[model samples]
Target: MGAFGRNHARVYQQLQQAGSVRLVGVVDPDTARADAIAREFGCKSFGSVEQMLTTHSEVQAASVAVPTVLHREVARALMEAGVDVLIEKPVAATLGEADELLRVALEHKRVAQVGHLERFNPAVRATLPLINRPMFFEVHRLSVFSPRALDVDVVLDLMIHDLDVVLTFVKSEVKEIRAVGLPILSGKVDIANVRIEFESGCVANFTASRVSTERVRKLRFFQAGQYISVDYARQDVLVCSVGSAVGAAHSFATDANEWGTRPSVNPQIQMAKPPITAEEPLLAEIKAFLRSVRDRSRPAVSLEDGRKALELGLAILAEIGRHAGRIAVGKG
Candidate 1:
C-alpha cells in the first residue's frame, strides 16, 4: 500500500511457503517499489489500489501496509471491492476513519484483521498462560531514534503494543488514564508514559521511547502470589510464584505454638521453564489472515481490536497535550 509494502510482500510469500495463500498482486503509489515487489514476488503490480482492484479479479484479499494516514482509504477501497483486508496497526490515524473502515468491511461481509504482530510472538504466547487476574503491569518499549515513523507519536508507534497486551490480560474497561509525552528528537512526541486503571482493579504503567540510545522490549505483570516477566525481543518469560508448601509450613508453625516467636518466613519462590520459540510473528500473522479468509473465520486481531487500540492511543495523546499545557502555563 505504501513504502512498507515490500514487507507485506515478503511476509505473504512466507505464508505461501507454509501452504496457506499466495500473493496475486502488489499495489503502491510509487511505481519503483511496486514494480520491485512484483518482480520479487512474481505478481502483477499496480500504481494504485483502485487500479489493482479494477484490473485483478482473482485477488481475494489484501494486506494494507500503508501509512497511518492512508490506512482508512486503502482498506475501505479493498473491502468495498469485496476483498478481505489485513490492515497494519494503529488501524488509522483517527478513530472515525477506523470506524468507517469497519463499517465498510461489515457492509461487504469480509474479514478485516489488524496487524498487531505482538499477539503472535512466541514470548507473548508463553506469558499468556501466566496472566491470571493481574493486579499490576509495567511495560517498556524503547527503540533507537528512527526517522521512518515520524508521522505518529510514540504512543501510536510503540506504546500501543503493550496497551493491547494489557487490555487482553485485564479484560476490563479502562476507568481512568493519565499520560505525559514530549518531543526530544522528532517534532512530535518521541517519548511517552501512560497509566491506565481498568475496571477490574488492574493498573498498568507503560513507557515508550523512540529516541532511546538503546532498544528494549519488556513487560512485567504482578498478581496475588506470582510475578511474570516477558522479554519480547529475546523471546523469554520468567515467572516467580509462591509455593503451596508455604501454607502448610505456616500451619505447622502455628501447631507448634510458634505463631509470634519468629517473623513469618518468606514463601519459597518458583520459576517456570521457558517455551519453544516459533516462526516470525509477521509471517504467522499473514498465515492466520489467509486461513481466516479460506475458512470464513474471524482473525486473531480483528477490526474492533485495532479500533480499541487506536482509541486508547488517541486518548493518551490527548492527555499528553493537557499535561504539556499545564507545564507551559507553570513555566510562564
Candidate 2:
C-alpha cells in the first residue's frame, strides 16, 4: 500500500472499531507492503483485487487509491463485481478514461465517490453557509518537494484541490483560463499559476507549488461587500464584512468572542471567525462514502464533480503548455 492507501485502511479500521463498517482487506501489488498495512489495520491483505474478491465475495465497497492510470481498471472491476468504489482524485489520467469509468458506474449502478478531501474540511464546510455572490478568489497550496505524487503536474497534484473547492463555491461554468507553469524539481510541472474566469463573472487565481520551502494551504475570496479567508490546514475561516454584509453574516458572528475577533480598524469593517466543528476530513469523507453506499444515495463528491475539476485542471495545463511554447519561441 502507498501512503494514501494506508491512510484509507487506517480510517476504515477506526470505523470498524466504532462498529460502522468492517475492514475487509487491503490490496497492493507489493505483497509485503499490503501485508504490513493489513497487519497494522488488523485486516487481511491480498496481492491484487482479484485475490481479495475471491476471498471476500461479499465486499460491499472499496477505496481505489491506486495510481491515476490504474484507477479506471481497478474501479471498473470492483463496480462490475457489485462493489461501490471511492476513486482518488484526478479521477483518471485522461477525460476519455474518466468517461469510461462514469459509464461503467452508471451501468453497474455503483455509488462512486471521488477523493476530493478538501470538500469535507471543517473550514470549508463551515464556510459554505457564508457564500454570497463570490466574485474573486485567491488560493495557494504549497508543499515541500517529495517524490510522492510526481506522476502528475503540480496543477493536478496540488491545485486540483482548490479547483474543486472553488468550483463548488462559485457554482458556475468556466469561461476562460490563463496559466503558466514550470518544471523545477520534476520532469513534470512542479509549480503552476492559473487564473480562471467563470461565466457568472467570477474570477479565481490559483498558485500551486511542490517546490516550496514552507507548506501553506489557504484560500481567500471576496464577495459583494465581504472578504472571506479560509485556512485549510488550520481548519479556520475569517470573515470581514461591512454594513449589509455584516448583517448577512450575523448568524456566524455569535462566536466572535470565543474564536477571537479582529478590531475594526476601519469603522465600517467588522471581522469575525465562523464557528468550526473540527473533524478529520478523511474520516468525514469516508463516512459520507459509506452512507452513500448504504443508502444508495449520491456521494458528497460524485464522479461528475471530480470530472469537472479535472476538466478545469486539464484546461489549465493546456494553457500552461501554450504559454511555455510562447516562451520557447521567444527564446528561439
Candidate 3:
C-alpha cells in the first residue's frame, strides 16, 4: 500500500473496529512498504498477491488499490481465487482492459465494485433526494499541486469522479463532448475544461485541475423551480427553491431569515439544508462492497458504471486532442 493504499488500509482498520468487516492483510510488491503498513495497521503484509492469498485463504474480499495499469492483473487474480474485489477509480488504463475486467468478474461471478469515492460523499448522498430533471450543471474540482495521481491526467485522475456522478444522475446517453486540456507540471494533462451534453437535453460544464493555488470541490445544478449547491469537501448540500410550494415532495421550512424575504416578483425562495451523517467515504465504500459480497447483491457503483465513466473520460481526452490539433494549425 502506497499513500492512497495506506488510506484504504486505515479505513479497513476502522471498519473492523466498528465490527463491519475483518482487515485481512495488505499486499504490495514493495516488501518494505507493505511490511511497514501492515505493522502500522495491525495487519499482515505480503510481497505479492499470490503469497497473501496463500497465507490467508480466508480473504473473502479485497480492495485492489494497485496502479491503474495493474488493475486488470491484480483483480483478475483475486476473482480467479474466489475473492470479490473493489477496484479503485479509473478502473483500468484503457477501455479494452476495463472490458476484460468485466469479463473476469462475470466469469467468476464475483461481486465487483468501483471505488468512485465521490458517490459515497455525504453531500452527494444527501443531494440524491433533491434530484429532478437537472437541466444544467457546473462542477469544479481543484487541488493544490501534488505529485500523487500523476500517472493519469487530470481528466482520468480527477474529472472521472464527476463524470461518474453525472452519468448516474442524468441516466442518459452522452450526446456531445467538447474539451480543452494541457499539461502544466506533469507530462499528462494537469488542467482541463469540458462541456458534456446529454441525450436528455441536459448540459454540464466541468473544470478540473491539479495545479491550482487552492483546493475546491463543488457541484451545482439547476432544475425546475430549484437550484442545488453541493460542497463535497464540506459535506453540505443547499437547495434553494422558488415558485409556489404546491404539491412539493419535500416540505420547506418557513423562516423569514432563512432565505431573506425577497421583494418584487420573486416572492418566496425556500431554502432547505438536507441532513447528512458524515463518515469517511472509503469506509462506506468498503462496507458496501463487503455487504454486497455477503448478500450476493450488486455494488453501489458497479463495473458497468465504471466502464461508462471510463468511456466518457477517454472520449474527453480524444476531444482535447481534436481541439488541440485545430489550435496548432492556426499557430502554424
Candidate 4:
C-alpha cells in the first residue's frame, strides 16, 4: 500500500472496529505490503482488484487509491461489476477520462464519490454556516519536499483542495484565471501561484508548494465586514468582525467562557472561534461513503464535483504553460 492507500485501509479498520462496516479485503500489486496491512487490520489481501472481487463476490463498495492514470480503468471495472466506489482526488488524468468515468457511473447506476478529504475537515465543516457572501480569499498549502504524487503538478496534487472548497463556497462560475508555476525537485510543477475571479465578483488567490521547508495549510477569507480564518492542520476556525458586523449575517454562537476572550487593538473589533468537534477527516470521509453506499443515495463529494475541480486545475496548468512559453520566447 502507498501513502494514502494505507490510510484508507487503516480508516476502514477503524470503521470495522466501531461496528460500522466490515473490512472485506485489500488489493495491491505488491502483495507483501498488502498482506502486511491485511494482517494488521485483520483482513484478507489480494494481488489485484480482479483477484479480490473473485474471492469476495459479495463486495459492495471499494476505494480506488491507485495512480491517477489508472483511476478510470480500475473504477470502471469496479462500477461495472456492481461495486460502489470512493475514488481518490483528481478524478482522472484528463477531462475526457473524467467524462468517461461520469458516464460509467451514471450508466451503471452506481454510487460514486471522489475523495476530496479536506471537505470533511472539522474546520471546513465549522466554517460552512458562517459563509455569507465571501468576496475575497487567500489560501496556502505548502509541504516539505516529497517524491509522492509526482505524476501531476502541484496544482492537481495540492491546490485542487482549495479550488474545490472555494468553488463550493462561491457557487459562481469562474470568469478569469491568472497562474504561474515552476518545477523544482520534480520534473512537473512543484510550486504555483494563482489568481481567480468568479462571475459573482469574488476573487481568490492560491499558493501551493511541495518544495517548502515547513508545512502550512491555511485559508483566510473576507466578507463585507467579517474576516474568517481556517487552519486545516489544527482543525480550527477564527472569526473576526468589527462593530455591528459581529453576528450580523449569521447567528454565530460561541461559548466565550470556554474559548476565552482576547482583547483586540480596536474595542469595536471582536474575535471568536466557533465550536469545532474534531474528528479524523479520513474517518469521516469513509463513514460518509459507507452511508451513501448503504442508503443507495448520492455521495457528498460526487464525481461531478471532482471533475469541476480537475477542470479548474487543468486550466491553471495551461496558464502556467503559456506563461513559461512567454519567458522562453523572451529569452530567445
* Each model's lDDT: 0.84, 0.92, 0.90, 0.92
Better structure of 1 and 3 per lDDT? 3
Per-model root-mean-square deviation over C-alphas: 4.0, 6.0, 5.3, 6.2
Q: On residues 94-195, what C-alpha lDDT tens digit does candidate 3 reach at each position?
A: 999999999999999999999999999989998887788898999999999988878888999999999999997888999999999998999899999999
Each prediction's number of clashing residue pairs = 0, 0, 0, 0
Inter-residue clash pairs, candidate 4: none
lDDT, candidate 1, at 30: 80
Number of the candidate with higher lDDT, 3 or 4: 4
- Angstrom error of the Cα, residue 175, model 3: value is 0.7
- What lDDT is reached at residue 148 by model 2? 89
Evaluated at residue 200, the lDDT of candidate 1 is 81
Q: Please identify model 3 stretches exceeding 4 Å from their true place.
A: 245-264
Question: How many pairs of residues in model 2 come into backbone collision?
Answer: 0
TM-score for each predicted model, relative to the true structure: 0.92, 0.93, 0.93, 0.93
Q: Which scores higher on lDDT, 2 or 3?
A: 2
lDDT of 1 by residue, 1-332 (tens): 45466788987776677667777788877888888888988788898888876778778998888778888888888888889999888899999998898889888999989999889888888777767678789999999986876788989988988888787778899999999999998899999988999988788999999989999999998876678888888888888877876644433232547765645578788888666566688877888888899898999899999999999999999999999999999999
Poorly placed runs, candidate 4 (over 4 Å): 245-267
